[model samples]
Target: MDLQQMRYVVAVAETASFTRAAERCHVVQSALSHQVARLEKELGARLFERTSRRVRLTAAGEAFLPAARQALEAAERARAEVAAASGEIRGRLTVGSIPTVTAVDLPAVLRDYRGRYPQVRISLRAGSSERLVDMVRDGTLDAAFLGVPPGFRIQGVHDRELAHGQHVAVVAPDHPLAAEHEVDLRHLAEEAFVDFADGSAARAQSDQAFAAAGLRREVAFEVSGVELMARMVRHGLGVALLPATFAAELHGLRCVPITNGPVRVERLVWSRFTPSPAASAFLALLGVGAPPTAE
Candidate 1:
């Protein structure tokens, strides 16, 4: 019957649990449940089948879900478009990035954004690319920097290559492999290594390379950030395979090239849902969004 009710229903459908949906909508569970119940009564159709273990949408709710989502997105688009027309952009923009992502010129971009739109609040969160992509898809992040393999595709977001570079192996200067300018994949099979957690973009490259070479190194330590990995390698915890940018400022580490290694591609990904005013401004600043037309 109203936008809020539709949003309640959509959130419920997306999350499958009334409590989680309520949390996502920033409403108490009781309030959200009351609205959904009211919506069902108004429509004279049961929306969800509730059970102790899980929630399932009835036929009516399943049919209503898409329209509900589209209506919400349409409203958001209209509001954003109107705000754009007034040329007043003041809102919060939340962005996500992989830990110590060097591919994006984030500092320069944020500096320019701040200079241009000081009123816009900006928030940044760092995580793995997989987690970042999930956040963007779930409406938690407006845009994100993700490290993806070349030609990779995912639903529900627009993605483009933000930066590209090669993966390099870095070791402590005194390590046995330090003298070699280029290290073969097979050589590291027996070496102790500091590696990323599973599903990292950098790790993806190494995984494929090692699989092809029929070699697997012992991961002595796992760290979330590349900078931390560099530190670990610097301290002789283990060597690491990381983006070339990680080795840029790392003075005490030896940078060794891997023969025909996986390429590290950083991509900018944003949800296809309607973006807020600040998000539009940020996108336009990056030359991704369309320019404003003269009246």
Candidate 2:
């Protein structure tokens, strides 16, 4: 019914103990209990079922929990938005990125943003695109630099291709594949390969490329990051198909272009709807979320 009540309910759901939740909320156990009781009475449903050993949410509580938490979060966001509107862009801004983007692209943008808006706190999370998209959808991040995987829905988020690059075969300097100027997907079919783990944008593109070429890649090592894959390849673990730019940057990694008949394109993606102010500024600087300039 109220923000305080919603907060109390969410705390109880999270901690599962009135005393602990109250302590976290900097309120007494009695007050917390009274607030939750008041909320339950207003809703005409029991929120929690208390036992000697533990407290559990009732079916009604479980159903109401998400909405209650969201309401509380929205209220807090509104307050922060008001504070931010006072001509000071000051609040925590969380941005997610795939590893390659973080390593290769984001530093300059982040540096510039920090110089311009030093009061705004910026936090970065580097992970696979799958994880980044989930984080953005769940409000964990204000926005993200995502690689558009083929066949995924892109409706809720607005995406534009920021920079385009292609997949390439990376190998050790002394490895046999290093001598090749460019290699086809079928050449790596019989070779031991270090492939990205599932859910990675790079892996999704590579999978599609391999499938189109009617070839099966023998994945010897399934790593999560491009840097790690390049490192493993440098040590002769196996060859991997990664972003050509990322592979080229690693000193010891030799990048051999993958001629898969059709080139794989990497896209920088961001959400279109309701991106936070900090995110909007960063996207604007990157020239992806804004209108074209006159020549």
For each candidate, the alpha-carbon lDDT, in order, equals 0.82, 0.74
Query: Residue 105 in candidate 2 has what lDDT?
Result: 58
Winning candidate number (lDDT): 1
RMSD of each: 6.2, 5.0
Model 1, range 1-295, lDDT digits (tens) per residue?
9999999998888899999999999989999999999999999999999999999899998899988987886686576567667986766788998765787689899999989988777899998888888898888788999876665566677777878878788889999888998977887777888888767665776787787777777888877777788788888888887787856667788888888776777888887776778887888888887423322
Clashing pairs in 1: none
Clashes (N, CA, C under 3 Å) per candidate: 0, 1
Can you write out model 2's per-residue Cα lDDT over 1-295, one digit (the tens) per residue? Answer: 7889989888988999999999999999999999899989999999999999999999999999999877875775676577668866656678888767622358888898899888778999987777777777667776777664556565445555555567778788999988899887788787888877766566777777778888887888898766677778888988877666666678877878877622434445565456556666777777756422313
Candidate 2 global lDDT: 0.74
